[model samples]
Target chain A: MSDPILRLEGVHKSFGPAHIIRGVDLEVRRGERHAVIGPNGAGKSTLFHLCSGEFAPSSGRILLDGQEIGGMKPAEVNCRGLARSFQITNIFPGISVFENLRLAVMRKHGLQFTFWRRVSRLDNVTQEVEGLIERLRLGHRAHTLASQLSYSEQRSLEIGMTLASDPKVILLDEPMAGMSQEETEYTVGLIREIAEDRTLLIVEHDMSVVFSLADRISVLVYGEMIATGTPKEIRENPQVKEAYLGEEVAA
Target chain B: MKLRPFLILLAVMVLLAIPWLVSSSMLNAAIQMLIAALFAMAFSLLCGQAGMLSFGHAAYFGLGAFATVHAMNAFNGEGLLPTPLLPLAGAAVGLVSGVVAGYFSTKRTGVYFAMITLALAELLHALAPHLKGTFGGEAGISSFRMPAWGFGFGTAIEVYYLTLFWVLLAIGLLYLLMLTPLGRLALGLRENQRRLRFLGYNVHALGTLIFAISAMFSGLAGALQSLNIEAANYAELETHVSTVVLLNSFIGGVRVFLGPAIGAALMTFFGHVTSDVTRVWLLYQGIIFVLVMMFLPRGIVGELVERFSGKRPAGEGIRLSEMLPRLAGIAVAALGGVVLIELLQRVMSRDYRALAAGGQWPEITMMGLSWQPGSPLTWLVPLSALALGLALVLGVNRRAAARREATA
Candidate 1:
């Protein structure tokens, strides 16, 4: 239980002359809600990209369930029990919410090349998609297009897509970036409910939500990890207080 | 849903009765219509469903035609390949060529994908003339349909039935494909390939498969064409064939299942009828295409489907009662435009200019009417009709706008 399900070792990423993520090392333990918090331009999203196979690290190893997945394609990484959600609400916007969820779920049933059987008749995929829709509280909006979803509802849909793969390690980048206080609270509860059986590594800017939801928190500064501990330890640490957490904790 | 089934049944019955009702020459035109319709439907599978607009589909169509002809020559309805089963040769070649071409083309998306397909077809088109044995240069390869399964395979009606059967089978398979899991993924592929990638799907493989399937059916259509005509030529591989299918699919509305077929069939029927009467038929087709694009960008069937199921445009829009007059107004305007164009076409002819070289300005006969070029009423009458139609249509537009504003 204490072993890390996802570990990034000495990961360095550079585009042209500018270095984005510099020698970042982090570990997300199995079944633990871990949050990576940082000020703007702190390489927070870059770290997520590196883990989710969006970009290959210049020099490093990304281990997902004890397998190296640093330079693998996004699909292969997902197949290795790791999944990710984009910060900007990535989903099939033109299709219905049910169709979006089903597209994410049908892969698990080995229906990729399947042409004979009707997708509507797939009871298992339908049931799983329905379960996801209910769990996300989007039952009423199942028939609506994904683009028609409200801001927070789209966020939930993104998270639901991430969960559709039943991944062992889920990387969520700013799942609550743009939301009201009430919506954020609802999402916090929803994340708590879903993250009970899986490991979650979220990149969130909301300090209160981070404090309330994360079992352990890591603060990233200028493409490096400055601190990693519980919320109380992060608040009290002198080094952390002087850096990113000073003004937020005070407020 | 209940109405849809009944409508389909009625359509099928109408298709079945086509052989008995039409003349032999008209039946030949009907055979051409089915081939064009099938080609458009095959195009919809890729362009409409998968969202990959191919500009080189005729390459697959040509490949299928040539392959079928070769199979007929080699086997002659004796052994494994029968006359009825010859289209399988085309399907096999189409699938193989599709896979090869799709592998390279599906690597890119949107404009790049279209360009690659265009280039591939051009390559085949350029090479086809030189490969005499395969594409058969100049005169092209000709063959005869053999008798099999207790049918003589003689007469235009028999050929029409055979073509109709294959086309319907291909279309039915295409329609059923939409309900399948792979078909669902096609919609996903169209929606967002990046999202599908993260969902653990081999996006490239999926794209290639869809492209190949589309090509497979396109090839089947080609086979039907050559079988109907009893010949296959390198001209079938030309870029115009590709563009015609694309134009037909778009004009018919690729978004609907039967829209492209309807458009292709109607266009083909018009082509057969108009080409005999008018020299500027292609120009007329172009004008119609532009008009449809300007006012009805969704294509005819696409517009109809949206009007019925999709959200009403802006306000509730005018009811059918109000719409009838507006449609008549547009039809009147179109008639004026057509008269003006046809008159201008006749006046600009070399023969007309040569005849007027004597300065006689003699009378001309057109559209079953005699008209003197010296008469101003000829021009004024069409212009007035055009004005009246415009005024009527504009009045309806203003009324609809006023209604919407009042409701708001």
Candidate 2:
């Protein structure tokens, strides 16, 4: 197989006295939907933070496309084509939905610091943002404030914003944290559609969605990955069953 | 957006015609008003647009004034740079100081950012006089505006026109800036800075740039102030100047594009009126500020814009018929307030005491009437007015609350 799109080599993270990620060696291959599933307090979010450059790993290397990106700032990491969404809805609430997406699209087109031109007159940026709005079904809310959007709609917008950068690797943190069954199914389908030709690293608690979507699953237990395998192999893995999936499978 | 340029043109026309119609004194006041308005707008860009509340904006304003004065003095001797272009010196100095100050200040956010700016301003204010050579001690630097562009700026009217030209151009450029990517990003920075970072924006650097841009305009205002007064003083850098700019911006409505202009004009005119007529002008100014804060928190223009905004959901609006009664009530209340305040001032005044000492009963003159202090009518009339004012204000407020609840 070609080199993995993202590789975490013995990554460890600690906050003062508490060690969160312990020797996390993981590889997310190109064009693969990789899901990290773990119980609460298993440092799943911490691991994502390490990968996304929100916090520097205590020790170890994080390589993105064969480049060391561990200690870089979030903006630098984002500029290198690694985009992420927050577990909490993170968007410019005062700005219109189109503006929120436009900034991202503009950044993708290397217009982050383009101040000479009026943003309203940027036809290409506008066209790209409108396309994104259409794709996310947010055309109706193009001019609405992001704060005024419904929770599910905001989640969808967040996903759309993540894609606006046209990132090589997309990391989604709890894409469906609080959603109805129908909303979840809708988002899962949306995620499937977007993740078609890109590398995806998702951290989700929904077992069914994870099993159905992930080409490979890494089961994290107490800041350590105990098992990583395909859905069938993971289902048959005794350690993952004992550590986490035991109750879900039995149920 | 299409109407914006037309409105700007209209504003320019009105401003240009003012000196022709108004008295020379009023023209002088207008020039100061324009300068203050520009300063306030520069501040609004930081506090209102960028979400950075700076308490020491006068630092840039004062520095600009000094720079302009020095430039005028130095260039006047050389006969190279025109008097009209002296403000560019102020802008340059302002930009340089903004970079120096912003570098240190932008390291922190929120209140810390405010404190750092305040400290920086205070430091300059204290140290400037001691510098002597640069600050000219307490007296400050002074320079004459040289004749330039074949137009001698000898009269107040000419200076007014010069000021009007610079102010309009600055305001126009600033407005255009808001439509630019940098300005839009400043809004985003205010809304969700962390989100911008995730979008690959260096938020702090952008903030510094905004700070510098705001400072440049502020400097221009200061430079104009120096030209108008023919002197730059320590008073320009004082906390009082900062407070004035803050008040003008807030009273006008920081969020609205022209709010600061309206505010600066109102405040400058008010200052002129109070200084001419009343000894207790500051008290009145304080009362006006409090009233504005309590009732018109968004500033005059802000409230008007909100009331008439097309973006407001349909079917909700104020009919003049409904508003006329409120206006009438407010006018009555305002009259009552003025009478009560005037009466109270007369009663407590040192002038009233001097009159009493001279064996004459203290009298108050108001609205074409004079009343002896001992007369029950004097007390009763004002007391009644005060009561009516309170009643009308309460009634209006209750009606407004009811309307809001109904809408909700």
Best by DockQ: 1
**Candidate 1, chain B, TM-score (2 decimals):** 0.95
TM of each candidate vs. truth? 0.97, 0.95
Model 2 misplaced regions, further than 4 Å: B1-5, B350-361, B366-368, B374-377, B396-408
Estimate, for each residue in B295-401, the C-alpha lDDT of model 2 and write its tens digit.
99999989989987776765557766546767776777767777767777887788778877888885677668987778888777767766776676578768777
The Cα error of candidate 1 at residue B150, in Å, is 1.1
Error of 2 at B183 (Å): 1.3
Question: Candidate 1, what DockQ?
Answer: 0.88
After superposition, candidate 1 runs with Cα above 4 Å error: B75-80, B310-318, B356-360
lDDT over C-alpha atoms for residue B190 of model 1: 95
Chain B TM, every candidate: 0.95, 0.93
Query: lDDT at B407 for candidate 1?
Result: 88
lDDT of 1 at A227: 88
Supply the TM-score for candidate 1: 0.97
For model 2 the local lDDT of residue A113 reads 55
